[model samples]
Target: MSLRGKIGAGAIALASTPLILFLGTWEGTGQNIVYGDKLARGLPTVCKGLTEHTSPYPLVIGDFWSDARCAEVESLVIRKGQLALADCLTNQQIGQNTFDALSSHAHNVGTSNTCASRAVGLINAGHLAEGCKALAWAPNGTTPVWAYVTDAAGQKHFVPGLHSRRRAEARLCIQ
Candidate 1:
């Protein structure tokens, strides 16, 4: 039977390892230092893309966190994302790689958007591989989504970094 509701402990544990590594690779550790997100136009962000909104505390410029502290916060954030993701997922018995990829995508985007995403909808409809591909492209299969950054001028620009990350997640999802 397809599992639903909250993600089980075993699945969480299995996905956590690769999810963490994947996040570190894409988000970067930021050397445990807070910096402004250029895409967000000076929004302060810390290790592994932790912003004031997501961080336990309000992030300020130049704030520093130890590596251990960064890891702790990253774990907390990922756990929260996983929980929210579980609520949206109709089938919780997905593979570890797929879970990790979805969790990573949810971490980058918000859980709400991830939940309402075409990828999730496709996954729920049992189109597993298609759902994975939807991470990089829209339903039309050519238009890129989640691969843009808003600038200070309120204009959106395509970001190669985001495209690369999404493609990586899609690859992991299908593995």
Candidate 2:
């Protein structure tokens, strides 16, 4: 082609690379955080805090009313689905601790202004399924994720992940 055509192509190619990378990292782009750093920062902090000072739950709910994005995560609890909640958050740390503070905070049943009820409801029931469904259907080129549990009879109940895939088994879990 002409010299101008070659320069234009080169410029387009160079501009696209960083744009792609930035989009990959942004939550507003596709919110690609499946089950690690992203979730940890949001829900884990909420759960841990409410679990600790039960008295502060009302305050928390009122203060952060706009952050419903984490309501599903707050629902991870002991009474509803303790084993799986623990399993999902196992070995997660918040500084020098292995998130025991968060775990301890989870056990108190105050029903105050905190997330214990939601967490319990999610764990015991399949409540997170809706959020899971929403996350799974969002189109951002994200891989599907799911959690599963094996029954005594060896049947596997698949937990829905962020993306929707027909037959991918990488999301198998034993919880």
Candidate 3:
């Protein structure tokens, strides 16, 4: 093979290596750890105070489910699901922080709802900054509500915890 051809092949191999490693064992682990820490230890938005507040999702927060193991498992599952949804919805490549932030938002809001969200649409359209900002909006009737929730009467309520969560996510997205 020509020297130039060999160099090109070597470059291709090197490029693919990180991706291979990332997609292999490295996948889902980072986001899981991040979200786990954020949720379990209490983010500025969710799970604050020592008083055992209710979780955003009723299904995840069952009776007597306020243990460390439960928090870890819930965070892991949420991050994994959100990351998968972000992968499916995004058209452009995003950084780890951005992806993780989106995962967090998606975790709070249902992945299916996120898929239909204006945030996802903006991301797919390459309006990433706008999309990240859009994540701050709370979905009506969704579990966890992250930053905002709508009552049965459709009144939108601002949740400090959810707002804090959204700020963190937006900050991560830009970084």
**Clashes per model (N, Cα, C within 3 A):** 0, 12, 3
Q: Is candidate 1 or candidate 2 better by TM-score?
A: 1
**Can you give the TM-score per candidate against the true fold?**
0.91, 0.15, 0.52
RMSD of each predicted structure: 1.9, 19.6, 11.7
Q: What is the C-alpha lDDT of each candidate?
A: 0.81, 0.28, 0.49
* Per-residue C-alpha lDDT of model 1 across residues 71-92, encoded as one tens digit per residue: 8888887777777687778864
Measured with C-alpha atoms, the lDDT of residue 118 in candidate 2 is 31
Top candidate (lDDT):
1
Against the correct fold, how does model 2 do in TM-score?
0.15
Q: For residues 12-101, what per-residue lDDT tens digits would candidate 3 score against the true structure?
A: 121123322322231232221222223333332222111122234432222243346444544555434644564456454555555556
lDDT of 2 by residue, 1-175 (tens): 3222332454212112332232123223323122222222333223222332322333332243233433333333322322222334312111111112122222322223113333323323443333223222223325432334345567766544312221211111100
RMSD of 2: 19.6
lDDT of 1 at 152: 68
- What's the candidate order when arranged by decreasing TM-score? 1, 3, 2
Candidate 2 residue 57 C-alpha distance from true site, Å: 13
Worst 10 residues of 3 by lDDT: 45-54
Q: Ten residues in a row with the worst lDDT in model 1?
A: 1-10
Candidate order, lDDT descending: 1, 3, 2
